[model samples]
Target chain A: MSAESYENEYGNAKNALELKNITKRFGDLVAVSNISLEIKEGEIFSFLGPSGCGKTTLLRCIAGLEDADEGQVLIGGEVVNQIPPYKRNCSIVFQQHALFPHMSVFDNIAFGLVEHKVPKAEIKMRVNDLVDMVNLNGMESRWPHQLSGGQQQRVALARSLVLRPAILLLDEPLAALDRKLRKEMQTELKRIQKEVGTTFMNVTHDQKEALSLSDRIAVIKDGKIIQLGTPEEIYESPRTTFVADFMGASNIFSGKADVNGDNNILFRGDIGLEILLPNNDKLEAKEIKGISIHPEVIGIALEESEIKALDSWHTVFKGRITEAFYQGDFSELTVKLNESDIELAIHLGRGIAHDKEIVSGQDVMVHWKWEHNNILYS
Target chain B: METIKNATSPQSDLVVKNKKKFNVEVPLYMGPISFLLVGFVFAPLLIILFFSFLKTGLYGEIVYEFTMGNIKEILTGGSGIVFLNSFYLAVQTTILCLLLGYPLAYYIARYGGKWKVLLISMIVVPSWVAYLIRLYAFKTITGTNGIINNFLMDWGLISEPLTMLYTPGVVMVGLVYTWLPFMVLPLHAAMEGMEPSLLEAATDLGAHPVRRFFRITLPLSRGGAIAGSILVFIPTMGDWLVPALLGGSKVMMVGNLVAQKFTIAGNIPSGSSLAIMLAATLILILYLAIKWGGKEAMEKLV
Candidate 1:
């Protein structure tokens, strides 16, 4: 369908960027399978996946750097599939900054303006404003090589922002910075996006970065998006085992779900463990093959009596502590259940009673409420 | 503590032994090039300088009397015209080579892909054939009854054979053909060293293809252009073979004038002075080129 009709039919007039059945292939390998998504104006969207999962390829297709073999890319309600990258009006900040080593910081930021034939005075004013916005004031005359890695990245950001593109594509922009600097830049990037009001589409493999920085995320694997939702939805209600594992929910139990009396469902794990699933209207009891519980949701008690006082809705597992790790803010205990050989990862906050005294080989009971279980169908 | 000391002592001793061996190996590595520089390069230059200040006998023998007449003769005579011709031709050849070489070098560096080695080899392999043989081949192709004229005549394009030889233009063709590879090699090296992402960044910044080339590619490859210009200019200015074979005395360069002075007139003193002047002029030009091209050009050439 034509871009106008597609937008009219879908009522996506407010979407800053929309992809319809976008697919890219590299010879025999499909780098990006048929994927469709819409990003609203002034929203920070991310494509999160492991390396080589085609997140970068999807971003490139959106930026017009890579042509989609089959599909339409509509930006601001105009189809831009045939337009080249320069004319598409979507700027990109590359992973390595890709700053012009030959040009000074001011000239680098002014390059797009000069190409567009902006007046000289206005170009200088816009570049100066961007330099100040990205916190690079008084560095207009320095070469790219003279700046630190973080500083160069800021220059790159300012250079792209000066164009005021309809959509800004960031390809692993913070993947090169140190952890602390990455966190700092994450905050800076959010502030800049808010101030500019331009839609941001970032591609990264870091789950934490995507969770922290993105308003909505599409988790991709093997050239297809397995799930697309807000950060909280993707984290708390993963629909597939891959999404669950990718979101850091390390406790996945593959089992068979059987319906019980009065609409109750019980999951019997293959490893001889069992749990009562919470009531979910959308779940098919026969189709649920597994379930995932986040590591932080599982609680540990030194004695069975400690958790026995709790209500009946909590499922308890008697286990012995196989290993303990003392992190700064919390402690991690690996519990091997006595009923089965299954190991469960539990996190105990520093405020928990006797958390510091927890040691390896200590007997313990691991328990979690049924409401914390996220059912996985496949 | 004793064990740590014992462990460290052997390593220190080994390091000292390696240092001693390295001291001896340094001269061993530098010996051949140093010998060649002193024996072939410096010695001939020093002899030329010594001969320029001496007098010449009637039979082209070097007379052991110091004289300033040879230098004075050059300054007062029509050698200025010869110098101007050489300068003009050198500049033209450098410009032509740059115009033709930059695009070819950029293409090979950027898009040659797996065939890059083969393409660059095609450029370099022809230069490896004997220079005189290649010049003769070029002459045969451009001669009056050569392939181009014959082909055109067969096709009824021209009525008579054109005067395609012994002109300054053919001399230029010969000079450029002889030195084009020198221009391409350094240019290719400089262009190949550039990061491809810079061009992509320029494109993403709303610069079109032509604008991207001028703004990003051209400025980044300036080092290669300067180095290629120098590589073409210095040799073309002093070349005698092209003018001798192609110009046939119709267009005499400074090299031909110096050759006639030494060979035909038997004026060794005058020839040496003229040669010294040419060398001095080239040195000055090289200094200026390096100054204008800056450190980037120097680094690329080295």
Candidate 2:
């Protein structure tokens, strides 16, 4: 579902969790400011931000690990602000996995069931089902230390999921794994969430992990949500330069906006270039301070003659290539405009930049389409 | 490519090399400590074992003749009562220490925050003073004319100074007081070493605070508890001074019996036999505790 619909799902029957103006303070420091969110039922939502941005604090508030000084937390349409973490049916997978070092995997997963006074026969059935679901069949008797990082992660998941929590809050659970394993667990986590149909709220500082896994993301900054949107919407149409910069690598230019002829809006960038925005109702604002465009959306033409020969529908500018980096699969060209200190980052395919000998200090032409440009508020 | 392979493969290669030399290297590193252990500890035990098998002269001197007289007499004699009394006192001390020390340890470990070091030092500071001096402080407190009785008498709360000292109950108090730090330190360390996320996970999984403590905190910190219990129990059992001084000559433990047999009675053979038997029993119990409690108990002792 889109982020708009998820936002409208607040206080409705379809929401699994709702936080209303939650604010948690640690003495003088506001760890989480006045924040409200509604996560749709069974949706994989993420609180994405840099470190110390209160994303994790907000998740902990929902889990009742930290008491918010001022707000209400509702789970399944029930106001559970006063409920203890144990009474609330929300399980959290810790960043460290936090598997019990003393207990075997089977016992670790069976602990919750034992606590709930579930029958022995049913505990065995549920434990086995979870062990199999996490792909820990023969490793049941292994202690947490015996398992690999990924295996320990699976056990942590099994241990929490066995309780059948209404929502699973994961605190950077995959941050410990290697790149390949992290990617694998990302898909594995999504698959398991689908199979179990539990609402998942994940907190992470890794932008790629958030972008790849979340159905919708809340980009938080300074203890407040800067933007809330689907992954594509957040990456493509960030509400502010902060959201755009935090979401991914983007070239942001400070500018003033003005309506031109017809329905077009022109942003007079301080970088000595005017970028055009096609007819859009959102662009009706009188003035805007910043405009953002993804680095990957910009194209670089090496030859000046080739740049001039390019047809319309392209807003082009000449700049000197100050730095060129040949990444493993792609290449990045940082072009400094001749008129100002502002540099536009243009990402190119490995074939274009690497196959051809591109170097710094060379003059290059940068261009992008009208629609790929986004106006940033402040 | 070769450099990349070499860099990546070195760790496994080093591990294999270390594994190959492990047997020889372990003993080499441990040789000096083992030598001291064997010389000071095992050699003394062996001498005691030899003395236990000897005959006693009329004047309590050691005789060269080999005999089982002392060993046989111990089982049939009133030594069983001494053992029972010592064990009972030790059990009480251990239980009292655990009951009193656990919550204190938990609070210091979990909630002491910036004052954790200060709180731990407070528990440890009393023990740093001479042992006898600390015991005497308890002695003064529990005496008939001690602070509590004098205060109560002055307030007309009692007709006379109560008989608060030199009793089995007073001895228990002394033992628990003396051994409480041993319980607190280990329990605090264990509680501090515990992964806080485990408790959070337990709470997240729908276990209440009490259930979390019983199922997670208590079970996980059991190593420390058992370690603390053993530390208090074993020492309290063998202690003759507290029972002799505080229990007044009315109570006697195995240590007092052993002390009397060697010094007052001058029966070296009986005392040696009794000491050996106690040592053997303690070793057996320690072995069983280590086996049952897993690696943490053994590690804590070391």
Candidate 3:
């Protein structure tokens, strides 16, 4: 739901929430360096990273939980530096499903409403509506502990959303759930964001979670946002070695840019092979060492004569398969061209690979759509 | 029965199967813990249960006859005042402990740095010292010429030493001091178990600091609060030492009443009955805590 909204096509509104040179330090450890980003109104922006990457810390700074040593936070284009969270029109759902254990589900959702001094019948109506939105109905009277982990998360969501805040912040809200439940919640959260039209900022370490839920994901690493892009951009065209590698495990080959040219950059390595990088003129690698292709993008053994077929001129090649393995429905083949190790995983019918008797150490032609190849720098 | 089992369904079946696989092989936290629990936890309780009902003589010897008369007399008169007082003191102690210990726990949990281990040790190690020694130290501090008054006098802040010790107020002070660490430890345990993101979530949710404390911190650490109170409340109810040393004779708590009945009045049966009543009241409080926790609270976390 979110991915489709602020896709690369729609780079999100200029700014609803903006962080300026924010930095957080805990004694000796710097949690977030001087980094900044702009989140659009009603945008489902996500801070994506591994655990301890300061995504949650950054979110906390936005929430006013942790003071940023160096930064400015603007909400709705207003400088909110002096404002406390309660006055900032934001609500947050925590990773542990921080539903008030003492209150019933109904009361838990109604709590913020009560704090804000909303009217009795209106609070009831809003709470019930939220509970229904989260697919929690009759369970309102139950205590937090009585609900399943998933149910507790829903209540947490309900509790935060019922307050009608300008922004809803979620800190790994689905981290506690099992895989099935997490996916279900990701969709539910997306639907809720769309329905409420409230900008949702989520912090998550899970790549899939961020990709599935975020309209735009800011990839944070070592206290800084290294890349901010849509899931498709992040997946199809990762900008750095870390971005390329961290997105998923892939076969990486580093080389020197022997020839730099427009639309095609020729690369050479100790492997005795020269490869052409199409549409990549700049690579920060002193030795064209930054170009890469995803494993899924590499096609299996096919016809060498087919290389002459009309297509992007720079994509077809011949190599020898050195290793192969059946990864679920698809078969992955490791091919070697000169000294460079290239892994080509092809999506195939489960039985076809063995039926065709594709073997390792066999000479195979490698082919890919030009767009699947990405040239990484630094 | 088949229908009932069927109604329980796949999830319950999995639970039962796991339960049989694990719980059947060993009782919950078995081996030394099991043996020691039966030895220390139940054996003394069984003995006390037996003696509370046993008839007693003027000489404080058991008459070996079951009677409710002793239990009745203790519940009836001025004795009820002590009952009310014990309850009032326990509630006060619980509240004060929560107030003092919660911030201490929160500070330790969130902000306590190199001093955290030290602070935690300070909270816990004092508990390891003999209970009598701690109470005696409390006595020395809160006495007529206690440390506080003496310090005030030496500083010429007061003309004479004030009478601060040996009153209901003194008893409460002692109880709060004694149980503050109890509340801190469990609160630390609860707050420690909490993800820091939970508080961050509240803050991000636009909850003010005070609102976050009430809405998030207080509710989440309730387990620790309940555990701390039970730890402090159960023992403090029957405590003779604090009241005797700090509260003096006029303070006359239920514990002092029990002491008075057995030692001074020479009424063994009445003391036994009062002891039994104390046990009943503790049980009721525990029941209320469990009920307050609600059905969700009963889930035994594995």
Candidate 4:
């Protein structure tokens, strides 16, 4: 949601966090450009992008770990641009997890409470509760070096959460873990966020992590927000080529659109071929960009009779398979249209992909519903 | 599991094959160095040990009697005071070096950035000058007729020259000046290797700057601190030049006492015994430091 709608829906007092036109520059490079966003109370929001794309920079600016060259950051609708990180009421889990190597697990969790001079009994109770929450109950007395990477990450998460800050910022908290551990931590993170009901702002370059864990994701590139929406919305209707490419592999065609009727437009691909799109009012000019169809959305069939069985709203193509790559559970077919230079990627699962005849140079028909194609405006 | 096994089994087989190759190469690697170490190092230490157990003759001859008298005297006689003074001076110099050098190392590591190499070089450049020359330079600076006294006289800050030379304090200043780089270099290395994100996390966790330094930076750099203390403390314990030149006759350390027995008094057995005692003290200090600092301390030196 936009900041205005967020403020209206949750009221100013409950908006949780907001950044108004925040920008940060380092010497000759603009690390984060003019970007404004809002996260609602108890929401799990994510900034997703490749490295050097300013997603982490933006998170740091919000956490007051970095001073933005322009604009204000708000926590609970209170402007915190002048406050230091300690006073901003936000805690961060660093990308390295940053567990204190010298301190025991219990002390690392109790560090913030000790700084605040909380009562000894209360500190013990709180740290124990957090240790249980992060599933590190019995290992409290062990040093950070003795723990594994996953356990260290749990300590880092508990350390930040024990303070009960207004928001928790995570900078690729699982990036250092193996793929299997990363998936496990993703679920653990989601569960903890739900239990605590704290606003979470996670930054990651892994699209799968953001898709599976985030309540809403902001797709960023070149220090700007390319698109911000729910994961399903972004997956279904990416507004830019970068978003489509970043989100996943897709058949991308940049072309001009000519109005066909009341609700239809013909997109002539730059490389070749033409496809139909349900007209969107946002596009007023003939110049069209980021016309993409997800590979999974396109269906493959061996016979022309099967192509005829598809609905009228579906766009079909007669193509020859240029290459067939066999993945363990599926096969990916790179298809070049019979009379056009345009290539479309089709993914077929094990049942349909096991056919002996579906090799390179095999003739096939590809089709997808018009609604599955995203027509982006320049 | 399957992928890892497939990838590593061949590499492990190659490594096992290489071990056979290493067996043939061992003589080439170990020959000259082992021979040199045994000839020069172990032979001299054994000779010293032999001398230390012998009795000293009246005219400084090597007597044929075997006795532990020299070692007994060093432990029980008034020479204990000299060892005490030497240890006191070394500890004081180490504390001062730590106090002054930690901030310098921190500044260079955190704020020097592009100028870090230049700044570290400045600390190291003075070592290139001869050690005796540096001591003489200190003498000129602290003497009654030196530049400091001359400048004070010209400025009318004092009517006569202050007795800054040949004092225990001046000796300490010299020792600290000489060893400060030893302390700073290791600390700078530790601070430079510190992951900056750790400090950022500390700040985000509601720690003020001073608290963060005390709680995080200080503890994490303990390895460097311990290593630096060993580097400065051990050598200062046996250093003769600083005490001899800067301290004059007023401040006689264990090193000067040992040197006097060997050269001025010409008592080789007595001198070797004294040297052995000093070496034993240094070893004790090293053992204690390594025990306290753990493997992390030794790792930082590497």
Error in Å for residue A36 of model 3: 2.1
In order, the interface RMSDs are 1.8, 2.0, 3.0, 1.7
lDDT of 3: 0.78
Per-residue lDDT of B278 in model 3: 83
Worst ten-residue run, lDDT, model 1 chain B? B293-302
Against the true structure, what is each candidate's TM-score?
Answer: 0.91, 0.89, 0.76, 0.89
Ten contiguous residues with the weakest lDDT in model 2 chain B: B293-302
RMSD of 2: 4.3
DockQ of each: 0.62, 0.57, 0.36, 0.61
Each candidate's chain B TM-score? 0.91, 0.87, 0.81, 0.91
Q: What TM-score quantifies how close candidate 3 is to the native fold?
A: 0.76
What ranges in model 1 sit over 4 Å off?
A1-13, A350-356, B1-26, B295-302
Tell me the spans in candidate 4 whose CA falls farther than 4 Å from its real position: A1-13, A280-282, A354-357, B1-77, B155-159, B295-302
Candidate with the greatest TM-score versus the true structure: 1
Q: Which digits, one per residue and each the tens of the lDDT, describe model 4 over residues A207-270?
A: 8888888878999888899899877777777888888888775788888877765767888878
Residue pairs clashing, model 4: none
Assess the local accuracy of residue A33 in candidate 2 as a C-alpha lDDT between 0 and 100. Answer: 91
Ranking by DockQ: 1, 4, 2, 3
